[model samples]
Target: MLKTLPADSRPREKLLARGAAALSDTELLALLLRTGTRERGVLQMADEVLQRFGGIAGLLHTEPTALKAVSGLGGTAKRAELLAVMELARRAAAQQLKEREVFSSPDAVKRFLQLHLAHKAHEVFCVLFLDAQNRLVEMRELFHGTLTQTSVYPREVVKQALALHAASVVLAHNHPSGTVQPSRADEALTQTLKSALALIDVRVLDHVIVAPGDALSMAEKGLL
Candidate 1:
């Protein structure tokens, strides 16, 4: 099918002639896929895959097992490539945070969290541990819960913070309901963790709520 298009209009040619930014999402994805199933064109399959996962942001959080279920990515090679690319994107974001004070680029922090937590079928609570200079030291998923809620233990969070020797932390959790607005329970848990960590002299910098393609910063809202 790609062969049927003009050479300048084909994904690879267009990417070479104009640059990757000029290509549509479907064209970029089709370039990665390389080939299509017998019944579908690569462009069509790529579009379907994007739609199935709710676009590129959702695809970033996709698990390997889920990739296998997609007919277009049925081959191990294809799935592995996709997984590798997603992992690389996450690591790149983490590296950026590790190199600078996270607050210096508020949007980078949210993008990093979204790459790690968004588009999940259930909830996840994670922490971004930071050094004295506010550079990211590490990120850990401390809790996983059902569709609506996760039970986070303040003691465990404090313990991890102590172990990591982190001076502060950015608390984050995802809402499967696709809402980044913090709930009352979310607010309560933030205060509880803030109190628990204060005893050890670790500050709670912010609480971020993540959903598919979106994130909210409680600090920006004066909720922290």
Candidate 2:
């Protein structure tokens, strides 16, 4: 298909003529990606990317350095495409993480935490402040704890929430151990902080415990 149709009939030209929506995934990627090498056309280059990475899902996890190992993808194109995808994914994850936040949903609370803290090795106790519309206003980490003490200062929590003019807050933390179960200390701290924060008129939306790939909401389990 690349040869018989003149260079004018190439993927780039076809894309320009028929709009990007009419192009195949490979063709669309190839256009944004511009040049491959003499040995491969844009489709072949895109095919190599898909084949080596095991398709789009695998591509998401692929690193730029690793991707450059492919034949046609050496030099600037490598970093450009990889960074493009990474930035797009980071932005997408951020939007999905905060958009339509139901504040009350177990999964929704987890989604927010996964965006904010699940990957950290250290214990970070953070708060998500919500507006009257229940949209996100601000998020702040009130404390960082050693392996044992993830103590959060309630006064500071209330202060930040009040400073941001937030109507409510959802507390979140990460368990490097990858367990979604809340520790006894986690539960005790939540109750303590919840009680303290309540006095300031900011509702505790939920206390979320984030694991590497999963999360648990205290409110969902009636723990809050």
TM-scores, in order shown? 0.94, 0.63
* lDDT per residue as tens, model 2, 1-224: 46566765577778777777777767766766666678777677887787776665455545557766777766775567666876576566546545666544556556556655655666889888888777777677888976545767778887898899988888888887768788888888888878887887778878888765578888878898
For candidate 1, the TM-score is: 0.94
Give candidate 2 misplaced runs (Cα > 4 Å).
1-90, 93-101, 104-108
Error of 2 at 151 (Å): 3.0
User: For model 2, what is the error of residue 224's alpha carbon versus the real structure, in angstroms, after optimal superposition?
Assistant: 0.4
The positional error of residue 175 in candidate 2, measured at the CA in angstroms, is: 0.3
- State which candidate has the highest lDDT: 1
What candidate 1 gets wrong by more than 4 Å, as runs, is: none
Clashes of 2: 0
